[model samples]
Target: MQNPASANANVTVTVTATATVSDFAELPATASHGPLRIEYRWVNERAGDAPIAVFLHEGLGSIAMWRDWPQTLCERLGMRGLVYSRPGYGLSTPRPHAQKWPADFMTAQACDILPALLDALSIDRDERGRMWVIGHSDGGSIALLYAALHPEALAGAVAIAPHVFVEDISVESIAQTKQLYETTDLRSKLSRYHADVDSAFYGWNDIWLDPAFRQWSIAGEIASIRQPLLAVQGHDDNYGTMAQIDTIAARVPHAQLVKLDACGHSPHRDAPEALNEAIAAFVLKISAS
Candidate 1:
């Protein structure tokens, strides 16, 4: 298929269900990758005028990796959905081999790439104001950033296993993952979703482990968010701890929180029933207000 990102800015193909179709948007040069192609997929688009839920993937996740979760959530919420692979993952453009991500990469995604994408897709001001960002891990951090930086653009934000600050545990786990990637089938498994698995893997891994990243923390900034927010984490999550959500609640007192038992890093997969319910109730409560 030809890259739709190559088309004119005014051109937009209404993305519908994946039913064997895919879509792409061209982000601007000032954005992360600058003039890059971002592969995306949609769900429940027939919901028509329903609030949009944009799913931002985990560090190593992609449109394919999200599988049917976004669809399932949209169905349950009776809302339209938008899920996309970031600049260096899935069928999207890959990062240059020699390029290393900056310590504040997630910030760039929130403040730059995401807004550019919404415009490229022609999401108007009204739609943006009613949109909700649902993200996980690094993506979750991006959601928090977006909500904080541009709260008026979002109806709400959901951060699952997000990192408000750097955790030693996260660095240690990622280092071990690097070893597993080299010695085991980790790369092979991720390759099933990404066009260039190396781009997906290293782009995420390199930054989190960068020495300067130790001082990285968005906890102070997230307090600026005025939109309803939901912070969730798994008690057994290895990548982060309950403090992640705890900090969110501490900063944004109105933020709702859900900590799951018998769950891990991926709560949507580990406890979909509980997660879906929490999110549903949150939307209802906020809408009623």
Candidate 2:
């Protein structure tokens, strides 16, 4: 892995003209189990009268990793955007070395951390009309879980490449990644965005590889998500298959599906314009309805 100093030295952040908000900011956070400071950013310049949209990054995502997409989307949709690094990712604190995350780490993120994050920012249905979630990869799963658990709190959600169930392909991809981190320069590359690259990687990688995780499915939870939703996936995505979005659509007939051609796991990175346009249109349509 790249040394911490080298990684820190290579860090660069960019905010685009399309972004409604820019610059790093702080939030007053109180963790459920510890006293670590949790910081967050908001893109609200164009939030005119629309509901707030929270952007949840992928398993390997960080606020910086998102570049300026959050701002762009927030501006395009005339909505507020919230972006933060979950514990152990990005500028957030590393996970406690002693304990392995529970099998339901995704569940805890949806049930616990998200709520706390909203509370820390003083956001809710009352203030933001109804909460809207835009999550990618792991964040997508958390979004689905949040919408499932708190349907009343959301207007709708957009899940980009979310995992609803475990597949051999997903596990195999993760296993390959584990190897890359160990044998290649992948860890060094990752260190640029992570305080503790192993903590961030293993926390996600280990749990997903656990035997018990094979049964980690959220397809059953879709029935409870009464809110409108948009599920987008790329055809070329190697990490997950169409089954992820298909299951949600099958369960919730009203759910909209968008399968992009030639795109990979990171739609925002691989096809930012298309992703942003689709997202902006979807959010507008749902909010107007």
Top candidate when judged by lDDT against the true structure: 1
Q: For model 2, what is the error of residue 225's alpha carbon versus the real structure, in angstroms, after optimal superposition? A: 0.4
Q: Where does model 1 exceed 4 Å of error?
A: 1-20
Q: Put down candidate 1 lDDT per residue, 7-48, tens digits, no spaces.
A: 233223321222324677776575346578888777998999
What does the lDDT read for residue 62 in candidate 2? 78
Ten residues in sequence with the least summed lDDT for candidate 1: 1-10
**Per-candidate TM-score against the hidden true structure:** 0.92, 0.87
lDDT on C-alpha atoms for all candidate structures: 0.85, 0.77
Candidate 1 local lDDT, residue 24 = 75
Residue-level lDDT of model 2, residues 140-193, one tens digit each, is 988889899987788789999999999898999999999998999999887876
Off by over 4 Å in 2: 1-32, 46-49
Question: How many residue pairs of model 2 clash at the backbone?
Answer: 1
* Candidate 1 residue-wise lDDT at 39: 80
